[model samples]
Structures are given as C-alpha cells and as structure tokens.
Target chain A: MTRIACRQLAPRIGDLPFNRELSAAAIRDAAGADVIVLPELVTSGYMFASPAEAAAVAVRPDHPLFAEWAAAAGDAVVIGGFCERGDDGLLYNSAAVVDRGGVRAVYRKTHLWDAEKSVFTPGDRPPPVVRTSAGPIGVLICYDLEFPEMTRLLALGGAHLIAAPVNWPLVERPPGERPPETVIAMAAARVNRTFIACCDRAGTERGQEWTLGTAIISPDGQVLAEAGEGAQATADVDLLLARSKALNSRNDVLADRRPDLYSPLLHRRAPS
Target chain B: MTRIACRQLAPRIGDLPFNRELSAAAIRDAAGADVIVLPELVTSGYMFASPAEAAAVAVRPDHPLFAEWAAAAGDAVVIGGFCERGDDGLLYNSAAVVDRGGVRAVYRKTHLWDAEKSVFTPGDRPPPVVRTSAGPIGVLICYDLEFPEMTRLLALGGAHLIAAPVNWPLVERPPGERPPETVIAMAAARVNRTFIACCDRAGTERGQEWTLGTAIISPDGQVLAEAGEGAQATADVDLLLARSKALNSRNDVLADRRPDLYSPLLHRRAPS
Candidate 1:
C-alpha cells in the first residue's frame, strides 16, 4: 500500500449541505490513497448543538449522504464516524468501514467517554475482526482507544490494522503533542504492534475548539505521518510487513505479554 | 522554595559503593528546593547483571547509606529507589522517602514489569501516601506507573505528588518523542491529575542505550521542565496548585469515573 489519507474534516456544525460538500472534496483528494480515515462524528460535528437537534440529524446506516462518496471510495477502505439510529430509535456513535463493495463492517462505540454516556448507550457486543480486501481490519471510535484491554482484545483476535476517528478538544500545550487521546492511540499501536490510522477533527465549531492530531502511527508507536496543528495528512502502510513483524516477533510488547498474570484481571468475574 | 535538583542516577548494576557515591553527589547539589527526587535503583539497579552479582549489592534497612543520607539530606524531602534484602533473602525494589527529619517511609514497588519479576519480588503491601512539609507525597518505582488503577489508588488515597524513579531505554520510533517510559509517566500525571516528577538515568553504558526523560509534569500533563535526552534535570513545582487541581477535580476523568459500571471488573474473578 502506498498511501492513506487521514482527513481532518472540520465541517460546519449542523450545516448538512456544507459538510456533505466538504467531505466530498476531501474524498476526491484522498481517492489516490489505499485507505482514507476521517474523524469521529465528522458526518455531524460532535453530533448535536443540543439534545433536540441530535434526534433531528441522526441517520441510519443507509443514509443518502454516504452514497455521495461511495463511488470515490473504489479500491480504498474509507472509514469515518456517523450517528446511526438503531432499530429501537436510540442513537449510536458508529464507524462505517466501507469499500467499493459497499459498507463492510460497522463498529459501534464501545466504552463511551464522559458526556457521551449520558447521550449514547453502550454497545451491547464487541466488534468482529472483519477480513477486508486489504487485510483483517479493526475499527474503534474515539473513546474505545482508551481501554487497553479493548485494543488488546481486538489484536489478540487477529486484527492487523485499527482505524480510529476522533474529535480531540483544543488543549493549549505542546504543539505536536496530542492531549492524552493521541497518547492512548499510540500506546495501543505499540502494545498491539498494529498500524493505527487515527484521524482527528480540526477547527473551532461555533464556540467549542477542537484539536486535530491526525497521524498514522507505526506498530512501534511511531507517528509516521502527522497532520499539522489542523491539516489533512496522508500515509501509507504495508500490511504484510506488519504481519511479518508480529509473527517473527522482535522487540515487540505484544509478543512479550505475561498472559498468565494478566488472565486473572482479564477473566476476573464480577460480583453478583 | 525554588531550584529543585532532580538526579538521574544509574545505580551500579549490583554494586553498593558505586550507588552511594552517585546519591551523595546528587544530594550535594540539592540546594534551595523544598524537595528532591532521584531515579529508581539509586542504591542498586534492581535487575541483576548476573544472578551471581545480586546478593553483593542488595542492602538492608539499617545500611549506613540510609542513615548517612537521612542525617545530611538537605532541607528538602529526598526520595529515590534502592534494593533491600528482606529476611527471606528476596530482593525488594524499594524507595525511601527521606527528609532532614528522618527516613519517613520506604515504599517497595508493588508492580513489577517484565524481567523485573525474575530479579526482585513485588511489595508485600500497598504504598503509603505520607504527609510532608512540601506536600502529600507517594512513591513508585519504574514499572508501577504503567498500571492506571495503581496510580489512581495513590491519588484517591490523597497523594498530591507522585515521585517516580525510572530507568528507561531509548526507543527508535515516535521520531523525537520521549521513550515509552516517560509517556507512561506523563499519562499518570494526566489521569491522576497530580504533579509527577520522574528522574531517569542518562548515558549509554557499554552498548545499552538509556533514555533520559527526566521532568516535572503538571496536573494537566504539561511538562513543566524537562531534562533533554541526558542524565540530570530539574523543575520547581507549585505543590499547592497541583494539590488543589486534584482535590477540587478540575479535569473530569478523575471526578466522574463510572465506578458502578467499572466496579464489576473489580470483583471479577481472575482470568483462567
């Protein structure tokens, strides 16, 4: 694979036409890539201006807006976040892993963070590691990356690449350093020894400022290609190489796990 | 108080005399600051270069080095890692929180990483959060910072500052980013919302590459002051401010943990 584009899509909040148009343009530019990743809730910037608006903009998996970029997604795995309405009418933060073959697998946000728990329900089941045309891919929504065990679960189950879409807030600190969110992603990459295509949203939305630490990190947690403070960045990864590294096992953390000690906490039973 | 001197000491792999000299020199430079911290393994690098060399370096609580430093330690509270031979002859990776008053508490690292298990035993009990003139302090060794729950335990127990002494190796990835050891330390600062001062060793001894990412991290996880890629560095902390941030709970991660949902995992039976 030659390139993957991490689109730091910062569409205007609540502006459907503008967001659709802007996302289309980004898709055109990323057409040259093997994979293109976008930030969480990029289809709708952070989802809602208010609870009332959330219900209005929420769409199901078959939303017409996604149809616009389907053709451009040919030969590429285009991954992005959106608000999906479940059969029960509850809204879920979900990622669509689509190829020209159509939407591949949908991963709902598992382990919601902070204010999200108030709005979105926790996912009932774990995401399956789907075999895509490119490789066996795993997708995680923003907060899903925080739990070490979650990523470990995906990796041990045979996931080679983890695609993440996030909306990081503006934190005034180091220029290139990401607010804890990016660090967690990098940690996941190293521990799993898998490629992480993490795209973060950029620009200020009305009043709330968002930080974009769009980057493609290597299996060793190296940020190979990083977007600027707020820019769309692109990268390329070799899946075969990553698999070889994992199989051969060099100085890899995932290879050296003391599973006997970890099994207790991982398999621990909750009190009744 | 200003001008805290953080000593990034690489104690003798298994030599006690060499370890004492390194600690004594760093103590001499501990001038105006109200606190001082040194890297773990100040008395003897817990990892044995050879199993045969282990017994020769491990010290006891009554060792003269402890008394000498206790009596002469500057007006500041000085803390660093050492090796203590328990009655069972098992070596413990211990840190002494020493002040001019006396040796306050000796913390044995409760969590050990990787190869550490073969050389040293885990602490028998939990680390104590001791009250000091500078602030409420807690001590942890190199690998202890990796466990988020352990650090949270320290914070919940009313620790305002965590002093960790580490020996981290330089890594090739993340480009200019600090080694993974510092990343974990910084994450501890962010998650716990406390000031974390990490003293790490410097220099490439023989062929081994030691990464020096010594620094003071603020409650918000910002590096207040950092020692470039070498031995020693120092940073003055506004202890009261860090304590207030942690106490009042400015960052919501610490404040709003969904212990109810997570509590299940607490009582969960260990993995088989």
Candidate 2:
C-alpha cells in the first residue's frame, strides 16, 4: 500500500517567505507518506490583481524553495503548485514534482482558469507523468483537471496516480452534494481506472472562498479519504491496482478505446 | 424546458415480440415528455448465450418496431437501444433516434462492454448528435459512456442533451455511493456543460442483475432525477442551459478546451 497525503493549507498572497515555510512544514508533516500533495499556488496564493503582482512571487524551478521541500519530504515524493517565472520571462501557473533528489519535473498549467489568462501564459506542453519512488505520478493544475483529454493523456502515458493541485473557488451546489470539481475528478479516476489525489486550498482569499475539497480517490472512483473540516486528507492505496485497466476478464479500459473515431476532438468546434 | 423521462423496463431475452410491445408501451407512457429514453437492448435484451441467439433478435433501422415507437411517441423524441443486424450481415449493439417523423438517426455502440465482444461487431462510426424537435440529442449505448472521448465528441458536435441507453450490470460499490457508471455520466455532463439522461434496464436476466441506475443530470452535473426504487426517472430541465457553455463571464467550458494538445487521444497507447 502506498500512503498518500494532501495538505490543504492556506497560502498568503504575495508572501513568498511565509508560504515557503508553510509548504515545507506541510511536507514535513506528511513525511511518512509515500506521496504528499499540496494545493495549487501553495507558494503564491491565487487571485492576482495583475501580472506584476503574480510575477512578484514567481520563482524559477532551481529556486531554493524546492530544495527545502525536498529536504522535508524525506523519502516521500512531494507535488505542489507554484507561480513559475520561466526562462523566457513569462509567468506560468505551474506545479513541481520534488523528491529527495530535488525537482524531478515541472508542468505548466495548460488550461488556465478565469482571469488567469490575464496574468499567466498557458503552457505549451502537455502535463508530465513523472516516475517516482511511489509510482509514476501525473501532474495537473486546477483547471486542467476539468479537461477529460488531459486526464486521458496522463493515463495513457502509464501514470498510476494523478496528483492535482487545485485552488477551487467556491461554487454553488445543491445541498448534500460534493463539489462539482470533485465529481469531475471521480469520473476521470473511474473512466481511466487510475488513482487520483486532488489537493485543494482552504480558507477565504480576497473574499474568494475555497471549496476546501481535497480528496484521495481510488481506482474504483471511491473517495477513500477527503478533507472535511480538517487540514489534511490521507489514504493508503494500492497504486498497482491502476497498473491494469481491466474491469473484468473481457474488458480493459485502455484497450477498449476507439481512437480512430476521435478525430473530431482535434479541431475546435464553433460555438453553438 | 424539456421534460425528459427515462423508462427503466425489464426486457425478456430472446423474446422480440414481447419486448417490442413493452418498449412501445414505454414510449406511449412517456408521451407527454419532450424527450423519452429507454434502456439499452430494450428490444432484444442482453446476456446472449451465443451469436446465433443474438442474431435471432437483431433488427435493422427500417424494422417496423421503430414505427410502432414513433406512432406512440406523439411529439416527443424517443431514443432507445436494440440489437442491430447490419446490412452486411454483421450484428451490432446500436441505438435508434425516432420522432413523429420516424427514424432520425442510428448510432452503433462504439465501445462494447464485457461479454458484448463475443456477440456483436464494434461500431466503426462515431456516435451521432441527432438534431431533434427538442434539441440536438446525442446517443451512446452502455459501455460507450465509460469512454470520455465519446461524450466529448458528441458535446463538441453541438448536442444540448445526451441520451444514453444502458444495461448496466450490477457491480460492487462502496456503501452510500452512486453507481460508477452514473458517476462517469455526471462527470461527462459537467465537463462538457451538457445535460445527460441515461436510461438503464431493470430486473435480472439470466441471473445477471442490472444497476437500474437511470439518471437525468443537469449541465452543472447535479442529479436532477434518478431511478431509485422506481421504474422511471424523470426531470423537467432547461435544455437551453447547456447551450451557453459559460460557467461565468470568462470561462466557457467548450472554449477552454486545448484541442492542440489533445492529439495523443487520437492514437492508442500500449497497455500499461
């Protein structure tokens, strides 16, 4: 069994020094787990008013902040979101995969959420499935999880678990229902037959209340653990169960894909 | 507003005459609804013992059975599944869309489920988004809902509502959880910003129990209505809500798609 933990922490906007320590502490707190996840923009809180404000807290991949996470991670592989300052001088909403060896992979968020388009340049490349000590872990930022193609891509790339760093802004839902984003995640997990750990931020930031809907979902699309009036959601999961996409003797999820008929998805459709 | 009704009927296997009347009666019973959906293979039933057994009950698009449904349908558009005998002599698991105008479109199940592979030839063409009096309604059959690509394709094709005809076999699920198939449909509905009505068969056939998980979901991914201990799941939904893909002013679900990065979905990946 692989132990996965998600720390739902509140990051102070434009406060790098404070966030750096808070994230590192969260990682240390979850040190025993095989995989640890923190919410999106853990190093720099969301709701940026301008590009300059976002750039103020943006850090390069080589920044010492990752090394701090690596030091605290112990043997666990830590995945967390950050404000990224790329070599080309553009800011990106990105996530970094850090293990004991330091930064292993960095994935820029390709699908930016509302108002993010004004502050960050969308990543050109697809999300990465980084091979880790626990397993091959796929990385996706908040809005990316809403895209079924993104999850399907990662699953096809042989990812056993997908660690998503999301800062889900509060949305209205019917009473007794889970957050819409969580529902989307559950569907993605079941269809791909892959485990998913979504780490969502907590606390209200600039009047934008977070959903605080961190969840660790199993391959069967069950919520093994969830952050409910708590700071962490953790689960011990058999990551190897995701290695086989078969649901029964005759049906394998990945093998049953009809890719030849999916060409329409490659082109954008005109608005209805 | 569209009054969608899903009739969860029990079809007796290998008894086409009985099933034909049962489905026509179901359509007539749901005549007041704007859109009526029926279970997959409602005309032939599932769990065939052999290809010959399936072939015995297979039908073509021009079969008089659909005319019976159309005659009883009134103004409502009806979508239901059947065992299809193709003109080329191959058998297919397919769904037909009918209205007062007769058969509008036929979509073969592209993703065949477990045990279905043994008796039916897989559909080469993509599922159809048939333009109807109610709106453009997409059709999917059984396991086809498990494939995110199929739903995404129909949503892109300007479908306001997706009508799925499913014969969901009973599967183990964690207590207090909805069926996994329903979860997948909810996710597909939300991500695509489209409404979905899944009509699932009820009762056991050949000792194969059904999930009886028929559901009507809104664009927001909430369960508008579900078949609990009842024979039908009905919901009065604003289909126009799905026409505007916008969640907010800045986020349009369909516009946010990064189709350029979705090329990976067009090719099959080696099994993990």
Candidate 3:
C-alpha cells in the first residue's frame, strides 16, 4: 500500500519564499505518506508577466529551498512543480521528485499551456520514471497531462503510478460538476490502467479560477479519494494493482496497441 | 441545426438479409435526421466462431443490400459498421458512410478487438473526414475509439462531428453509473472540442453481454441526448458548435498541440 497525499495550494505569483514555506509545511504534515504531490507552479505560481520574470523566479534542483522541503518530507517521497532554470540557461516549467536522500528526478513540462508558450521553453523529452518504495512513479506537470501521448508514454515505460502536479484553470462546464481536467485524468487512468494522482491548486490568480482540489483515481477509472473543493486530499492505495494492465483474461491495454497504424500520431503536423 | 439519430440494435450472426431490413426500417424512422449512426458490425453480429464464419458474413461496398439501404436513406446521411471483404481478398471490420448520392466513405477498423484480431485484417489507413451539409463527419468503428491517436487525427483533419458506431461489451465499473466507455467518449469530446455521437448495440450474442444504449456528447463534454438501456436514442444538435474549438479567448485545443514532442508516439514498438 502506498499512502499518497495531495496538497492543493494557492501560490502567489513571484512569491518564492512564501510558496517554499507552504510546500515545506505540507510535507511536514504528511509525515507517514509514501508519496506527497503538490500542484504545478506551486513554488512561484503561473501567469507570469514576462519571460524574464519567469526566468528570474526559476530555481535549480540543488537550491537550498528544495533541500529544506526534502528534509521536511523525511523518508516520504515528494513530487512538486517549480519554475526551473535548466543547464542551458532557459526557463522551464518542471516537476521534481524528492526523497530524504535528495532530488531523485526532475521532469520538464513538454506541453506548454496558453501564454506559457511565450514564458517558458517546452521540454524536449518526456518525463522519466523513478523507482520508488511502492513502484515506479512517473511525473508530469499541468497541461502536459491533457495530451494522451504523455501519459501513454509513461505507462508504456512501465510506470505503476503517474503523479501529476496541476494548476488547472477552470473551463466552462455544466453547473455543479467536476472540471474537465478531473474527467480527463479519470479517462487517462482507465485507458492506461495506471493509478493516477492529480494535485490541483485552489483559489483564483489574475482573474483565472482554479479547480481547487485533488483527485486520486485507480486503474479501474474510479475515484479512490477526492478533496471537496479547496481541501487537501489523501488516500492509501495498493500500487501493485496498477502493475497489471490487463482488462480481462485475454486483453491487456498496452499490449493491444497497433503501433504500425499509429505512425501519423507521432509525426503529427500542427493543425492546418 | 443537425438532427442526429442513433439506432441501438441487436443483430444476429450471419443474418445479413434480416439485418438489412432492420437497418432500412431504422433509416425510414430517422427520415428527418440529417445524419444517423448505427452500431459496429451491425450488418453481421460480433463474436465469430472462426475466420470462415466471419468471412461468410462479410459484404462488399457495392453489395445490393447497401444500395437498397442508400435508396431507403434518401436524402439523409447514414453511417454503420459492416464486415467487409477487401479487394485483397482479406476480411475487414469496416464502416460505410452512405447518403442519397450512394456510398461516400468506407473506413475499415484500424484497431481490432480481442477475437477480431484473428478474423479481421486491420485497416491500413486512418479514418477520413467526409464533408457533409451539416459539417465534416469523421467515422471510426468500435475499438478504434479507444485510441486517442485515432480521434486526434480526425479532429486535426477538420471533423466537426465524430460518428462512432460501437458494440460495447459491459465492463466492470461502479454500479448505477455511466460505463467507462461513455466517460472516455466524453473526455475525448471535451479534449478535442468535437461533437461525438456513439451508437451502441444492445443484447447478448453468443454469451457476450453488451451495454445497450446510445450517447451523444457535445463539444463541452456534456451529454446532449442518451437512451436508457436497450433503447434507440436520438437528438438534434448544432454541429457548427464543434467548429469552434477554442476553450477561451486564448486557448484552442488543436492549435495547442506540441507536435515536436509527439515523435515518440509515431515510432511506437509493440509493448514487450
């Protein structure tokens, strides 16, 4: 069993010190969790005014603030998104996986969302799967999860659990309903037969309202646990269940793919 | 405004003549509809005992039955799945789009399900967008809908509405809830911002139970119309709504795709 905790936080733009303290506090509260996930841009917040501003707020994995959070996490694994300063000196929307030892993996956001295209450079590579106490956990940032290709690749790479850190802006939907972001996560989890943990930020930023919650979905596509709007969510799940990608006695989702016919999917040209 | 009708049928194996009559009657019933969709393998029931059994039930596009159905269809466009005997002498699980002008498009099943892999030849090409009076209609069959690549391609090809003819086998899910198939359809529709009409067949065939119903989802991922278990469902919706893929002032789903990072999707190797 993997005890997972999701922190839905509302970080202020450019408030690095305050966001770091908030994340550290969340980690301290989740003392017994095997893994704790925080939302995208949780360290500096989204909606940057300029590329230079975004770059200015980006941090290195070895930054002292990350070390403080890692210490607070103790033995538990922590996954959270931050503005990143890559070795190439470009700013990236990246998520890092941390443990008591140090930073284990850092994944740059491959699919940038609206306005982010102008602010941060899109990561060229897909996120890497890191071995964990429960199983291999794949990390992805906001908007990256919208592309099925991203999650499918992680699942194909043998990820037992996908940890998504999101700052989801509310889209128009029927009144009294879960946001489309949550619905998309549920579908992706079912199709890939992989356990998914989504941590979305709460509160509005620059007139953009967020979903303000966390949703943990099982391989069967059912919500195992969810936070009522603006609440922190936690759940313990058997990660072993996700290792089996079989839908029935004879059908396995990943094995059933027809790669030969999927060539167009890879070489997709921008919508004409 | 486009009037869409979905025929939820229970076809018998090898009963081509009877199935033809049933389909024609449904077309007659949907006379006022702009487009009507039928279930996968509607002409010949699914669950073939052998390749020979499937081949025996397969028909050609120029088959007399199709012509009669087209004539009965009159002015309205019809889309339905059928077993096909390709020119290469291979059997395929295919869907034909027929109108007053005759057969407009034929799409063979690209992603064959369970026993279908052994009996049917997978389609070589992707589904096409056939221009219609209502809008561009994209057709995909059964298992093909499970792959996001298939739907994304059609959406990129400028399809306003995706007509999916499915024969959905009931899968385990939370009780008294919409099946994962419906959820996936809704998610796909929302993500692509495309209107989707899924017509599913009812009843058991050779001991295989099915989710008997039909669901039409709008671009916002809300159900426009749905039939109760084992009923023919119909609804009229504005296909023009799907033409606007923009979620807000700044975001458009199709235009936001990061084609550069999706290369891994194209060079997929079958899962080990």
Candidate 4:
C-alpha cells in the first residue's frame, strides 16, 4: 500500500519566493506519505502573459527550491510541475520526480494546451516511468491527460500508478457533477487498470478559474478520494491492486489489444 | 441536425425470425430518425454455449431478414449488429449499416469479448467510415469501445458520428450510478469531439445480465439522451457540432497530437 497526498495550492504568477515557501510548507505537512503530488506550475503559476514573463520565473532542476522540496519529501517521493529553464536556455513546462536521494527524473509537458504553444517548447521525448519504493510512477502535466496515447504509453511501459500535475481551467457543466477532466481521468484509470493521482491547482489564476482540488481514482474507476473546490485531498492506496489488468477470468485488458488493427494510429497521415 | 434513435431490445438466443421481427417493429416506431442504431448480436443474441449453436443462428448479408430491416429503415440509415455467416463460411459477430437502398457497409467485431473468441472470428480490417446524409458514421461493437485506439482511429479517419452496437453485461459498481461503459463512452466522445450513439441490449440471456439501455452523448460529453434499464432512447443532435475539434481558439484536438512521440504504441512487443 502507498500513501499519496496532494497539495492543491493556488500560486500567484511570478511570485517564485512565495510559491516555493508554500510548497515547502505543504510537503512538510504531508508527512508519512509514500508519494506527494503537487499542482502544475505550482512555483510560477499558469496564465503567463508572455514568453519573457514565463522565462523570468523558470528554474533549473538544480535550483535551491528543489533542495527544500527534497528535504521536505523525507522518505517519500514527490512529483510536481515547475517552470523549467533548460540547458539550451529554452523555457519548458516541466515536472520533476524527487525522492529522499534527490531529483530522479524530469518530464517536460508534451501536449501543450491553448496559449502554452506560444511560450513553451513541447517536449520531444516521452515521459519516463520512474521506479520508486512504492511502485512505478509515470508523470503527465495538465492537458497531456486528455490524450489517451500518453496514458496508454505509460501503462505499456509498466506504470502501475500515474501521477498528474494539472492546472485545470473550469469548463462549463451542469450543477452537481464532476468536471470533464475528472471524467476523462476516471476512464483512463479504468481502461488501463492503473491507479491515478491527479493534483489540480485551486482558485482563479488571473481571470481564468481553476478546477481546484484533487481526485484519487482506483483501478476500477472508483473515486478513492476527491476534494471539493479549494480543498486538499489525499488517499492511501494498495499499489499492487492494479497489478492485474484482467476484467474477468477470460478477458485480460492489455493482452486483448489487437496491434495489427491499430497501425493506422501510428501513421503521420490520416487513414482514408 | 440529425434525429437519432436507439432500439434497446432483448433477443432470445438462437431465435432469428423473432429477433428480426422485433427489430423491424422498433424501426417502424422510430419513424423519422436520420439514423437508428441497435444492439450487438441482435439476431443470434450473445452467450452462445457452442460454435455450432451460434453458426445455426447466423445469416448472410443477402438474407431475407435484412430486406425487412432495410424496408423498415424508411429514409433513415440503420446500424445494427447480427451474427454474420461470412463469405469464408465463418461466423462473425457483425454490424451492418443499412438504409432504404440496401446494406451500405458491414463491420465485423474487432475485439472479441469473453467467451466470444471461441465462437466468432475477429475482423482483420479497420471499421469503415460510411458517409450518410447526417454525417460520416464509424462502427464499433461492444468490447471495441473499451479500447481508446478504436475511437481515435475512427476520429482520425474523418468520422463525425460513432455508432456503437453493444451487449453490455452489468459489471460491479455501486448501486444507482452510470455504468463504466457509459463513462468510457462519454470520455471517448469528448476527447474525439465526435458524437456517440450506444445502443445496448436489455434483459438476461443464459443467466448473464445485460445493461439494458442506451446513451446519446454530444461531442462536448453531455448526455443528450439516456434511458433507464430496458427502455428505448433517442435524441436529435446537430452533426456539425463535431465539425470543429478545436476546444479553444488555438488548440484543435486532432491537430494538437504529437504523432512523432507516439511510435512506441505501434509496436507489437508488449513492454515489460
């Protein structure tokens, strides 16, 4: 079993020092968790006005802020998004996987959402499935969860648990229902038979409203724990519960895939 | 706008003539729909005890039963599943796209569900994108809907509406909530920006319970129409609602895909 904690904090844009302090406090408070996930761009915030504005707040993996995060992580693994300043001096919307030892892996956001394309370069490489004391954890940032291919690839790569750091903008929906992002996440967990921890930023950023809080879904698409708007959420889950992808004795979800029929999905040109 | 109807009827196993009559009557009741979808294996029913028993109930495309279905279709296009006796003389759990003119296209079930592999031959080719007066309709049967690749392929192949014929057995879930199948369909529709019409069967067949209803989901993931257990469902939807896959000004869902990084998904080797 793995104890997962989520810090759904609202960060002010360009307020690096304040955001770092907030993150450190949250990590320290979430003690005894095997893994703690924080929202996307928690350090720099979302809704960057311009490329220069975004680049201004970006930091390298070796930044002093990560040391605090690592120390706060204690014996746990922490996965959270940040504004990354790459070696090539380019800006990226990235997530760092940090443990007691140090930062283990970094994943740049692959499928940039609206307006993000103008500022950040899309990550060319697939996100890594980092092996941890708890289990294998795969990371995805915000809109990357909308693409099934992203989760599918991670599951194929042996990810038992997917950690998502999202800055979810609230879309219009009828009263008393989950957001589309939550719905999509639930479906992803069910289809892949993998546990998913989605940490979303709360409160409005600039004028855009965020779908605040977090959703921890089990392999069977059950909501283990979910926080309401502007609330923190956490869940203790059995990681080995997702080891079996079988829906029934005769039907194994992953083994039933017909790769031959899925060839059209790989082609650059759309199938006619 | 296109008016769509679904006939959620329960067919007794191996009862070909009675099933054909029931389908025709329902099509007549639907009256003025642009398209009507029916449940999987509507003719032969699901849960076959043996191959010979299933083959006994299967019919060829040119069989007289299709003539009645085509006539009952009126001016509307009908998408319904049947036990198909293929040209190779093998039985296939198949769906036929029929209209007033005749049968337009036939799609064999690609991913066989539990126990089905023993009786039916899986289809080799991808499901067709048949052009209709309302829009292009892509076909998938039952378990195929569980695979995100199937829906993504149809969307990439230029389908605006996906017609699903399903024989959904009720899975374990909390009482008084939507089934996981419905959740997956809603997510598929939203991610693909494609309207989905799922026609599911009702009642029990050989002690196995059925989901027994229908769900009509809009491109935005809203349930335009839904039916309770054993009830008929219908909705009038604008086909052009799916013309734009763009969620916002800058992000077109299909175009936003990074195909370059998805190559690992095409490999036949299951990653450890």
Candidate 2 on A58-129: residue-level lDDT in tens? 999999999999999999999999999999999999999999999999999998888998999999998988
Q: List the residue pairs that clash in candidate 2.
A: none
Q: Model 4 compared with the native: what TM-score?
A: 0.97
Model 3: docking quality category: medium
Q: lDDT of model 3 at residue A242?
A: 83
What TM-score does candidate 3 get on C-alpha atoms?
0.93
Q: Model 4 segments beyond 4 Å from truth?
A: A266-272, B266-269
- Chain A TM-score for each of the predictions: 0.89, 0.97, 0.95, 0.97
Consecutive 10-residue window with the lowest summed lDDT within model 2 chain B: B263-272
- Top candidate by DockQ: 2
Models sorted by DockQ, best on top:
2, 4, 3, 1
Q: Write the per-residue lDDT of candidate 2 for residues B1-272, one digit (tens) a residue.
A: 78999999999999999999999998888868999999999999899999999999999999999999999999999999999999999999999999999999998888888788899999898888888999889998989889888888888889999999999889999787888898899999999999999999987889999888999999888899987533788899889988888878888888888887867544756434
Candidate 4 chain A lowest-lDDT run of ten:
A263-272
Count residue pairs with overlapping backbones in model 2. Answer: 0
**CA deviation > 4 Å runs, candidate 2:** B228-230
TM-score of 1: 0.80
lDDT by residue for model 3 (A76-154), tens = 8999999999888999999999988889989998778778878888888868889976679999887878777777888
**Every model's TM-score:** 0.80, 0.97, 0.93, 0.97
Residue A87, candidate 4: C-alpha displacement in angstroms: 1.3
**Over the stretch B96-189, how does candidate 4's per-residue lDDT look in tens digits?**
9999778899999988988898999999888888998778999999899999889988988888899999999977787655688988998999
Report the lDDT tens digits of candidate 1 across residue range B24-114: 6677666666677887877776556654566678887777787667665767788888777888888888889888777789888876665
Model 4, B229: alpha-carbon shift in Å?
A: 4.3
List fnat per candidate, in order. 0.02, 0.63, 0.44, 0.57
